[model samples]
Target chain A: MQIDHSENIVELKNISFAYGGKNVLEDITFNVHKGDYLGIVGPNGGGKTTLLKIIIGLLTPSHGTVHLFGQDICCFNKWSKIGYVPQKATNFDNSFPLTVEEVVTMGRYGKPKNDKIVLQSLKQVEMLEFRNKLIGDLSGGQQQRVFIAKALAGEPEIIFLDEPTVGVDLKTQEQFYRILKDLNKKLKLTLVLISHDIDVIASETTEIACVNKKLIYDNNPENFLRSEKLKKLYGSGVKFVFHTH
Target chain B: MEAVLSLFFIHTNMFDIFQYGFILRGLEAGLIIAVIAPLIGIFLVLRRYSLIADTLSHVSLAGIALGLLLKINPIITALIASISSSIFIEKLRINKKVYGESALSIFLSGSLAIAIVLIGIAKGFNINLFNYLFGSIVTVKQIDVYLIGILGMVVIGLIIFFYKELVYVTFDEESAKVSGINTNFINTLLIVLAALTVSLAIPIVGILLVSALIVLPVVTALQFKKSFKQTILIAEVISIVSVFLGIFVSYYLNLATGGTIVLIALGIFFLSLFF
Candidate 1:
């Protein structure tokens, strides 16, 4: 990993949050550097999404400080600089009536219409051909790509994707990852993905962390599976089944 | 020919209510609805809060009942109470421990109870029922015109200034907030706009047709367009034409004004559905 003494892309410290009087995240601390593909994995309700929200300045933790681009999040004014592809969050209405081009163009909401940005982002995800197709008419995977294109409209340096592959076919998931990999390599954009698929994370991400309430950073997946910490996380019966080197 | 001619030369020669003032007032109110309804409708429809639109209008029924029971302006009371109810919905949405639909249903039924109670106690409602259930163009005075005009400007101004935020929050709220779109403020502002638009429109289209005005045009517009600007613009144009044509036809045919407008809008929406 190239360690540049430059800006910390995302930083959260001692973050604490709760929903329904139950602790969702307690003492969550992590830092994501520029060009880091940090994949977060944890069981259901383990605060993976909550952590992403904190980093993106979406939800304010009960107690914590979040810094984006090395500035205090509360005071940071550069919002258009971040691209976020929230979980497909859209239902298949079949009649939604919006074309892929229009959906992708939504990413440039606050910025000047950058055709180049739109085209490049689509090409990065290899969805340029379907830019004119209606979103409701696309397959689950293709629709996900349009959404990814929408998030990339502003050409943000850091991208946060919260479960981008949720509820899609396995082939589509692989295709989505291929697009993501191309973008990460070509643009050098810092990618933070929240996922439960450890296999995908193992193959794709340079930095992988196991998060549940608190975050342990730089814990090599190899080292993690060997240790007893993961068994406790996934329960005694569940063990990490490694799929790749 | 006579109507259009009379519109241009009415005040100088004619002295009847049909002169320009009545038609102008109706046209003005319709114009305001044309602008406000589609935007609010987009949010309401996206959030599956179309029922809230129904609930709000029903609640506005009680509000209008309060105004009528007190022998005052119903639109104003509706504006007040409907906005309050919308805010209440937002507050409940955040509580997270409670169900949102339950909040909407409780408020809806509670407002219905108030409306029924008020009607029972108000001594037969005095034939002014159409003003609440089916709006009249005649009830729109000069003051109502100015009120609609001003609120229309404020709603449009706020929407124009916050277009991106509104769109972001509407489609993907979590991403919107993550990208720093101030979802709370935007959500409240949207509900407030929805309440205000519904309240103001209730006076012209009545509660039943008001949600139609807010939704159908946008639904029609969505059939072809994708960008918010294009979608809203087409819906506005359709609304303007529908309102204008509906008023002329209603006035000439002696039919109900609000019903005529909504029916015409429905016709346009149906036309958009064909190949």
Candidate 2:
């Protein structure tokens, strides 16, 4: 048998993580393919963020082998190929004296400075007009857009967002998801979004991974909504209203 | 007004101050610090490590006191003490056993206590201690000038080489780490550079007030709406002007040079609030 390595951008095998001797993730295994929008959903403290951290190499898994872009993660040095927006983007210090353009330019580090690419990223997020404005002066939703623009500035093949809409209003969140969906479809960019909203995960993502200290379900989002795994993960009286848009 | 300005400029007394070698040396040292202090301070303030500046300066004071008691070069000793303390602070921060500010306060008080005890043992408040405490740039030797110049160059050179990395880490450590930046190395290097800056500054800025040089100009610039790069440029300008004018005024008024410079910076900071 032959394997087509180009299909998969990320591969994980028997990954587990423990904090202070308590297990947060257990023997998790999954693969993210090129251009796939993967949504990871789980309960609070269920290790969704930790799993994303492990994938991004922010946290080292206690046990397992991981590969990115067909190379072992330990030896992978091409980090510009992927972008990460951490969970604290919404809570970044408001007084930080950085303009939007400067913040976005950080994403292009180790690469030659390119004003055009920076402008393109800002334009993609509809924040081009505010490029010269200080990040502290922006609203929460606007700041979120700027952070996404920062991640996009690098032109990465994959972008990982950990609760990108945590502090965003519901109306803005819908718009935010629309922009993400557009990026995935138009740019063919791979996305790995860790979110707690089950409905959003089921409706927006192409694939869903229900994680609760273990891999509960990993399949198409539609099947995930129809399955009983979500109820099992959340316990009795759990309700999920799936929306198709 | 123009005639009065011309008469003041032509007065021989005004030009005589710039002719003295000690005054010239003091100006040189002050100018170098004016450039490097706030350059490092912007990152320090942004990362919320401004208190570390104060802590390291106190540690350098203890080292200076010890060096004086042992008949050694105080600046070298101060550098050693500050670098070691910076390393320890980084260790404490990573350990997560103590709060960051608590770690800083511990070092701050510990070093200050050591300095006071040593000062008492060395026969209480000597001229040498006073000079170090309030800064006597008039006593700045040629060797001190060379050392400060070299150290300032190293700090500026390192910052230029690691500008992007430093900015990335300061803005967002977790994201920078994920982006393949060696965040631990950068963090340690930043603390080390900050320690070096404090040590280099002590001879001219004094132990009690070195952080003012490192922090005040940046804060003043923060009052303006500007890009990070622009803020740094404005901060450099503010620092340079304040240092030169402070030294000039201190010479005429016979005030402590360090305190004068810091007061000028404070004045600028307050003025910026209204803008």
On lDDT, the candidate that comes out on top is 2
**lDDT of model 1, residue A182:** 72
Candidate 2, superposed: residue stretches over 4 Å from native: A1-6, B1-12
Best by TM-score: 2
Model 1 regions lying over 4 Å from their true place: A1-7, A62-65, A74-76, A90-94, A109-113, A213-215, A222-229, A236-245, B1-20, B69-71, B96-98, B223-227
TM-score for each predicted model, relative to the true structure? 0.86, 0.95
**Share of native interface contacts recovered by each model:** 0.50, 0.83
Clashing pairs in 2: none
Residues B109-187 of candidate 2 have per-residue lDDT tens digits of 9999999899889887568778888777965888889999999999999999999999889989999988899998999
The TM-score of the first chain in every model comes to 0.92, 0.95
Colliding residue pairs in candidate 1: none
Error of 2 at A204 (Å): 0.7
Best by DockQ: 2
Docking class for candidate 1: acceptable
